[model samples]
Target: MKKYRKVSREFSKHTINALRYLVKKKIISQMLGVIAVGKESRIFLALSPNGEKLALKIYQIENPSFKQHVRYILGDYRFRKLGSTWWKIVTLWCSKEYRNMVRAYRAGIPIPKPIIFKENILVMEFIGENYTPAPLLKEKLPQNLEKAYDNIIKIIYNLYHKAELIHGDLSEYNILNFNEKLYVIDWSSAVNIYAPNARELLFRDIKNISIFFSKNGVKIKPVESVFREIVGESISQ
Candidate 1:
């Protein structure tokens, strides 16, 4: 574990400062170490003032690599006017993720509990036991493909019907395989059902999952049926 360092709270500040701001905001008190430095966000193991362990995800403002986020953010109706600036897009992306996660949580979907979020810092409940992040589904394929496919399908169902949302970008990468269960993560691209392109995104999400499961030998019906069943709307062939 790396020692926790003090830094600035704003995105203009170094990443450490951004983390410090999260601590001061009571989003997290301190961090044990960095977990994963991903493309969009860096994950860290932190401590609450009350001593509970938390996960801090700091979105890089300066030098924020939004190379892959372009498609999803541009697709959302809520993120219009995010001009060509990279930081502006990153800020909006984090806000979207926090809002979507909160909505999903209220609807009883299995999402990480969001603690607090600033312009770019997001503190959330850590899914792992000590410090390690839960492995992604791509890393840890479920031993039984059938059960894994079922779990993912159920999650998609709840996300649409209960949360009234669609994960605009989802795949094995955004799904965590932990404690013999499937936990959805990386909600930075999730969009509400009222979004203009919500159904298209949902169909894409289901199709990706179906493709993965099929490759693993789990039989799945067409993505169409899955989408209709989840949203409770019949569609023409």
Candidate 2:
């Protein structure tokens, strides 16, 4: 129970009810433990009644950085008319992440399959074996550097062209290296390609990936060239 205090403290009445609802609906049999914690959400390792593993991400309504989420939500046409309350904002944020993951999954990108979401809680496929969470790219370096870089690039290209979305924040920290396969996580910051700052965000994402691979001894092309290949245009300096 002590290990769960850190996560339970962040759950509000609404989130508590939402979790209960998940249990009632049999979406999850029981929560196993906290897998990870971020500034805005806590990831819990959970189990299904049928013996399947799942990841539960519950967003904190009182997150200090709640204001930052508005930028991502405002540009998302689906939630354009979102209310201006704290609860409304955070719930919308959770929805945004679920929607983005669905888009990426349908695009054939390597990502956790989104199962369901309600209010501030989201359930998805767990990415690991035997209840152990997979390590981030920053923690576990890929064995095939060249192939890894190429695969990541392909994901980026498909994300933009096929899904019409851009991962606003892409870095080694947000990508998971599971069994030599790359899975991009943390889609809360992703935005539609038509979002106001989409181009800028896309450029930043490309630069981040390019820099990471370069440091890992993979000689990649200039960021600008890769960006051009992705977006099919040159941005004026």
Candidate 3:
């Protein structure tokens, strides 16, 4: 929690900028609640003037040591050639996540739809209902194993083939099990299948996912098979 505050402070300038942009753009006004203070972002549950609820993610670019943070985030291929202004890189990185989320949502990948993205703030569809956060997959394992396994496999296939993306941080931590349906969040680490390190990222995602599901009582294959299927041998791991 303290870490989140420390990071959020980095976005002071960006947040102020986004707020000005949002208000100027006539986006949102009412405040409902705060969802979570994640390691890298602060999430808020807000209400619009018309009384519709929404989720907003505020990204932090400070912490001093965040210079190398890009190595860990997903979909970095888009802004690799951009000059090395740390704030610019970080801001672009957040924007990249928003774009990926929009793509995923369009491909029916069960990701939150991006409402708006400006500077470091991203507004998205709130995944929860009734003022509660949709439970993380870690906290909400399914009672029916076969059905859940099939759902997991289908989503992985969709994200891998149909969406042409690999969710690099696809552990239970990033999956929301809402009302018995699975929704993926935290796309900051998602990457295109053709990224230079795509195979490596895909393999790690598979390992993280399989390990998490197995611990939750669903057995899955090794990362190699997933890599072969998703990345193909010609991609060069």
Candidate 4:
């Protein structure tokens, strides 16, 4: 087995064991390096035994805001009966992201294909080249902003109508722009359409995307109009 990077020591025992399990099962050969870090998780670049690049997202077991994550999981019927233990919650959150990605990918949404998840670690298709991650939409604005804007709107529509989910935390930061193609990421906070605050979350997602494209010189419909068009009801209604 290849030696892990120095940063590997930061992972929890469960995470380390999970990685070992994946290696033993030939799911991934080894982790290359950290690709990105967020408040509650870290994404690592990894390789499969067949030399395929993959993204490994490890949710922090000791994340201080685990309590806050309850809101997203609570209203989603699929996980309603899950336990409240912190580790279990983190694991559930990781599973939520993988399942959300699977739904989006199956719906033909531009997203990383979810391979599998174990404990709090999620392995998925990497969206970059040669161990370099794709630039985020915020980092590298596309030259054709108009087309990008349209693509995002269409993705939002499909996610709602076909996938039956709403990206609760959609923003440029979680979107990748690789070779002028857009792929949504960080789906841990996404919720089903039947969630209590689904409409509010969907509206916020639309508003965030609309504000971004409009400020970047792309003509965009009003946030309310876009929201209503997707949800089939006015925000006020």
Among these predictions, the greatest TM-score belongs to: 4
Residue-level lDDT of model 2, residues 1-237, one tens digit each, is: 333334455567898788778878989777777899999988999888797999999888888798876787667787787767899888888988999999999999999999999999999999998989999999999999999999988889999999999999999999999999999999999999989888888989989999999998998988889888988788654
Let me know the TM-score candidate 2 reaches against the reference structure.
Answer: 0.94
Report the C-alpha lDDT of model 4 over 62-129, residue by residue, as the tens digit.
88887887888887988876656888888888888889999999999999999999999999999998
lDDT per residue as tens, model 1, 141-211: 98888988888888888888888888887899898888767788889888778776677888899999999
lDDT of 3 by residue, 41-85 (tens): 788776665667788887766645446556645345575565367
TM-score of each predicted structure versus truth: 0.85, 0.94, 0.86, 0.96
Q: Each candidate: what lDDT?
A: 0.77, 0.88, 0.73, 0.90
Ranking by TM-score: 4, 2, 3, 1
Ranking by lDDT: 4, 2, 1, 3
**Residue 22 in candidate 1 has what lDDT?**
63
lDDT for model 4, please. 0.90
